[model samples]
Target: MKKILLFLLAISSPILSISQNSTTSQIDETFKAYTGWFVDAIFYEIPFSDTFQIPWVLIVLIGGAVFFTIYFKLINFTGFLTAIQVVRGKYEDIEKHGVDNLYGEDAIVEDILKANQEDELNVAGDQTPGGDNIETIRDESADGEVSHFQALTAALSATVGLGNIAGVAVALSIGGPGATFWMIVAGLLGMASKFAECTLGVKYRDVGADGTVYGGPMYYLTKGLKEKGAGGLGKVLAVLFAIFVVGGSFGGGNMFQANQAAAQFTKLFELTGENSGLYFGIVMAALVAVVIIGGIKRIASVTEKVVPFMAGIYVLAALVILFANFSLIDDAFGLIFEGAFSGLGIAGGLIGVMIQGIRRGAFSNEAGVGSAAIAHSAVRTKYPASEGIVALLEPFVDTVVICTMTALVIIITNFNGQFMEYGVEIKEGVELTAVAFDSVIPHFSIVLTIAVILFAFSTMISWSYYGMQGWKFLFGKGKITDLVYKVLFLLFVIVGASISLGAVIDFSDAMIFAMVVPNIIGVVMLSPIVKKELTKYMNAIKKKEIAIEEGAGDLNDQL
Candidate 1:
């Protein structure tokens, strides 16, 4: 603990000094001076004409989603019911136990089990000359840390936060209501991307000697590519992914969350003085440290309960407003559709609207960005594709459902055009959303404030696990290394709240999206493997269904 404190003090000394000496705007400007180039490079837009251009990263994200949707034959649409079933444990029997006669022989099953056992022992550094005594194949399904629902909620907590609230508001404000149309389209396509990468996360994951699971893009990019004879390239991509994920965890996941949550809490209560943010930061950091230190299983446990409650409250509120203004629903949607195609009165016309929508959707769900894979990779299931299918629901819930609700409320409330002007950029999106909600439901901003804090807390914890995995990948899984990372992460929560570093946050957002580069390349190349896994899982389900029908027939005959 002394070492941990020393580390924290060393890091915090300079940060606190800056906060005490510099104004928020000055600190922001200082950060921009150093990080502006990297931010500009990451978000650099390529122009198609004099007026229209898009970020290359967005193209990669959307393009990969399109390709995965095509390659998987639209698994996003077809697997929706199956995903629900998987989460509900309807197929738990098949996932936990082998389908009878599915592989046809014990020898084949033994070979597969032995290969996995050897890999696990190798990672744990306990493999002997002849290996330990052989175990039954049933244990293969018991390797992961969290159940399907837990994994789903854990990943959802990260992606479904401020983006669903503030981000959707921003997209609509800039691109007009038409942006909503493209956002939904992009979200639907993003489901396929989620399915593909998460499948790889499980297929190539490592199970430690302590039954702890280690997986994500870092593992798959290395192990999956090595299987395809691209070992060197795979290692390179994995390292880069690890680096980017760590930076993202610090900036976007930890700091950005704390910063936004503090901002909202202070604004709502009308708290005054410079110490308000600092006090909030300290308390928030303490709460986050408690949850994150328990690791993924603990994080999953909390998120499973928190994600649903927060999401339900926010969605329920939206539903209340929507139901109250039932007559405006049709008009709002009409604006969305017409704006999507015609780009009427919106900047950059149809293409601009599409870009704004797709960009926000991609950013909101992070479907193709690969961070979700880290969370989903911890799911307890023998079949990798089952978890992948479960992961697809993230984009559906985040972008298609929650973000849509947010956009609708903004549009419906703007009937008088008093709240906001169409096509004008809005910087304070969360405030805008709060105003829109409060216009319909009095004191709704208070509920929104609680929701924002919950969103930020959950996001920070989940991303702590993500960044930890990457930290372990680069620095080894030593106790001291783990403590160091955690201490730094907690300190970052304080720093994020105590100061304003807009450029730092932007740079982190770039780092998060930058992950899409290596991740998309790896997943696309390994998509054939995802296909094989999907086929294997589907075949098992079919066989299980047939056996159930046969048993029912036998029972009928006996009767």
Candidate 2:
């Protein structure tokens, strides 16, 4: 294993070295060429169906959230508090109530372990009929596998990357401050979608013989639909989600992440020249190779630490910007509100702003995309519903909180110059954000550089986990299987940097939307189950219910 990894690194080193030495002009040219192709694809290559009012993915994502909101009686809103408690282990007994009966009242230590070993196949394993278990991950995760805080952070790492800093900048530029208002609105409503999908993720997750837990929209769509006597529908949706998830894992999740990171590295370090992205891509591929080679444990470990620190630093910087422009905050909010509803002539009018807000915001948090469920499914819990409650926090934090802070910085920075006037086309990313920050603090570009890099790194690690899971979903689980995916994932990191990936990214973004088509259907169809789980978990938490000696067997860590 070490030799193979070493050989791959040896071959990639020169590619990284050469690309890093490329000139800035070359990078820009490459980027433009790629962007041009993407534009063409959207206008000419894509099927006529996509020319509709809004992309179909955005519709299912937002539409599904709305449906679940009504059907589940807004559990995301009502159960928010309980979710906190559940994650805190407040409902341990209620959760333990449903464990298998193999371990009776007098079951000994050996008996308990033996019983759990039998139940292990459901804990996420190499025997999931398809998915492989790489790295021999023990289902009984070590103490630091991923705490509730770590889990949240791990998931957060994936959601709060370039999307918040770079993506928000673009949205505000194209859609106007009014778009910010709708972004928040989208974030709020997305909470419900996060809850419904995550709940089902836990309910239908497949635990493996190795004790590792594997669960996601794929598991729930197939399992939940089948339980509802819609086996055909479930199977189709599950397959569709798995296929799209794989594409998403590769394109939006992996390559895009690498592409952004390579760009950040080049800009921040002042590495100038052509094929610079390729060189950085090589470096990124190498680093990612190391982490991803370890699979989920390594990915979770790094993200748990990186996510919170990066977020804290970014948020603190934004707070400073907000404090500097305290008076203009109201005006900014006003602009967001008025622009969202009234159309500032900047966003293609009201309809355009709404679509931009929903599309960007949903992409940012990934509420209905079902990716979060993949991460949450690993949380240690007996009840499939417990983690769902905890999962609701993701969107609120990602879009509502993180994205909001970013918007404020950009909005307040434009207090005098007019945010809507600045067009979306920017030569350098660090500059767009630096321009925003330097409004208050001079030479703040350095700080923005650091923030972007950290944000990119955290995001890269988390997405690695998401992609690995998707890889396992299709390929069988095992160490060799995982290594193959990680290596390929790393190679893409290099590819993303070296070449213009407009076509690849567009296809991936489309694939991400396509995920919503099937995943939302699954969540919507079984929203009732989500409601039931919500009620059950809440009732148990409220009553502080548990058996003194009744809660049997250890719950799989996080699943």
Top of the candidates by TM-score: 1
Instruction: Please write out the lDDT profile of model 2 over residues 278-330, one tens digit for every residue.
Output: 77777767777777767566677788777878788878888987987799889
Task: Flag regions of model 2 displaced more than 4 Å.
Answer: 1-52, 88-145, 418-430, 545-559
> What TM-score should be assigned to candidate 1?
0.90
Q: Estimate each model's TM-score.
A: 0.90, 0.80
Strongest candidate by lDDT: 1
lDDT of 1 by residue, 240-358 (tens): 99989988998999999999999999998999889899999999999998888888888998999999999999999999999999999999999999999998787899999999999
Clashing pairs in 1: none
Candidate 1 wrongly placed segments (more than 4 Å): 1-21, 101-141, 552-559
Candidate 1, residue 508: lDDT: 89
Candidate 1 Cα lDDT to native: 0.87
Error of 1 at 344 (Å): 1.3
lDDT of each: 0.87, 0.70
